[model samples]
Target: MRREFAILAILGSLLLAGCSQLERLTLIRPSAQHRGYTQIAPRYDFSGKHGRDTGDAAMLLAAGSMFFQRGQLDEAEEQARKALKAQPGSGDANTLLGLIADARGDAAGAGLLFRSVADAAPANGVYANNYGAWLCANGRAAESLDWFDRAMADPAYPTPVRALANAGDCARKAGQPVRAEASWRAALALDATHPQALAGMAAMAFAQGEYLEARAFVERWLAVAPDEPAALQLAMQVEEKRGDNVAASRYRSRLQAISPGPTTAPRTQ
Candidate 1:
């Protein structure tokens, strides 16, 4: 789950630096999966839902993590605080709290909380991945790679593919197309159905002017994540490029159906 948010914000910094290469490339907006957090947040604990204590540190940590993943910062912070009250220096609680700070745009505070966990436990893959994501969001992609590596080094990481996909996304942001391709391929080798990897591969193909191939790749991605507006946009663009006006029009109509409004924003890479 933590792997969903790798640290590597190099490309974003490049944008700040006014890198000209990005002008020719499609910029990829981060997907929910790439943001790497999606868990449910329950506001109240029902009486005797289970034998678990409502305020138990572990329970609080889990609920907090879920809330943080779902982007419910207030609930997550509340749970994390309760967990901390029960057991200070909790890695889980600290991670959730840090994530909440990040969502709220408190980079300094989030960095501090993430550091508390990463510094305390170097071998913790989850913390490493999450910290790396934090570093990237703050425009430190170069420094985030090692943290991603550290996360994958641990066999206990629940989802190594997430780290791999995140690393690929970071590579693209850093303007290393070759590295990005390799990372995406690696992710595919691990899990052929990985949505981000497929979508990334599609983006790579589109960048290279291989419209048909890009279509195929993104079609696979759409199968995995049917609701992603970006994928539909890609499909429309790819069909237009391939001279299939009928299909292109169909995709355009679909896009309009899903997201009603002006369709004027330039598509991202």
Candidate 2:
């Protein structure tokens, strides 16, 4: 009886230890519930399976978006092309192709593709927003703002805060600091814990030499995304600028540890 009791106690303790370790692992992992952004791309549901072409262009476009998100640019492009072939004026297909092109560093091609889609479906808030973001990234701030406004005006738009964030980025890049601040504040009003808006505000504050404000925003970002490299780098810069040498050094060490090493030099001729 004594041996049996001892064995049961050991098993119970081992189970409890396993549970504790599992809890710790779950805490450290990124959770979908906490993430504000949608999944990079979602899978498509094609009712007809592999080869049926019953006018399911939307499914093809969605499949392309999923492929693009998974970093399979070639497959994404193929799917997008098939979608376009099935429906010549498919805004979603063109948008997916544009995204794939953009991801593959073909900016000009992406611009052309996005422009065509936006022209075809002027009322599609998603297309307008995506095109606007592309324009903002390409330094066409004025044009981007126009598209953002168009997107925001659409009552059917699901993610207005995202469009507002893009508009804020355009305003910031265009040197309209006051407007940028207002747009970012509006985005925060929509989604108080929006990471992109917070990060943008932090960057603006840092540019103005406001290290404390920048640090606060960066801390918020870290709270949401502890391992984000860009946020980590910015936090280190802020700490260094604020004369927190010890903190800065710690961050620098972390950055060095996480960053990839430089490539070796090639042999001379």
Candidate 3:
């Protein structure tokens, strides 16, 4: 289990080419409860001799996104590469490939690819999301905000909740917990059970010495994601803070049994 919580689960957003193909990702392949995604018509204005190729690439990229969500990396890569081969300027294909590069431990290559797509499609919500995420990952969280705003500016952009959650997460990471909570609250108003927003609320409460509030948030999060390690950690800490030695000990023991170490919550994929 990857214990690290991330605001942006990368590869940006995918444009929908067909209804059935896109619905699979929204319903069957959600990464988490807060993982609602949007699939819309291609942002690329395919035209001229390459119009068919660009359209084909869009379709292929959508297929690739499903595979990517399913953790079928090779198949996803094949689809993405085919899309790129069909239309070299396809931002969709580039975002997929860029995420693949990041997963493969080639952050430099991922940065270059994400930057290229972002530069070419400044107004594209998908590229903006991707580039914002890339910037956040590279210690530029402050700068990431502009791109995230750019993404949300597209009225047609689906999943504003995810963008809000990303903003909250980035703000939290940047040591602005109050601002983070405000963003999370906004997300919660839209989606009450959004896991990221709930977890963030729990974290903020915990850091501020509000143990019971943190515990409440933790319980809510666990109801949605029962086996999440970070939630478990939060639970144990809150219990300990509340003077429930037995509950804390039990949670700690459970954490020790399930994870590599009870205390070391290292970020992972």
How does each model score on lDDT? Answer: 0.66, 0.62, 0.63
Q: For model 1, name the residue pairs that clash.
A: 6-133, 7-132, 7-133, 9-136, 11-173, 26-269, 27-269
- Candidate scoring better on TM-score of 2 and 3: 2
Q: Per-residue lDDT tens digits of candidate 1, residues 1-269?
A: 23322222223212212323222111111111323333322344523263134556656665555555455668767777887787677666676676566557677897898778887878767777767766665677667778888878977665667667767777787787887788789889999988778878898899899888899998998898776778888888888889999998887887899899755432545
What's the distance in Å from true for residue 66, model 1?
5.5
To one decimal, what is the Cα RMSD in angstroms of model 3 from the true structure? 9.7
Per-model TM-score, in order, reads 0.77, 0.73, 0.71
Tens-place lDDT digits, model 2, residues 146-265: 988887897766578877876787788777888888988899899977666777788888888899998998788777766655667788888888999899777666666777653221
Judged by whole-model lDDT over C-alpha atoms, candidate 3 comes out at: 0.63
What does candidate 3's lDDT look like per residue over 1-269, in tens digits? 11111123323122122222111011111111112243332342222233334446555665666566556778778878887787677665777777666656677787798789878867656567667766666677787777778877866456767767777777766777777788789988999888878888887888788888888888898888776777777788788779998998877777777776537532310
* TM-score for candidate 3, residues paired by index: 0.71
Q: Count the backbone clashes (under 3 Å) in each candidate.
A: 7, 0, 0
In terms of lDDT, the best-performing candidate is: 1
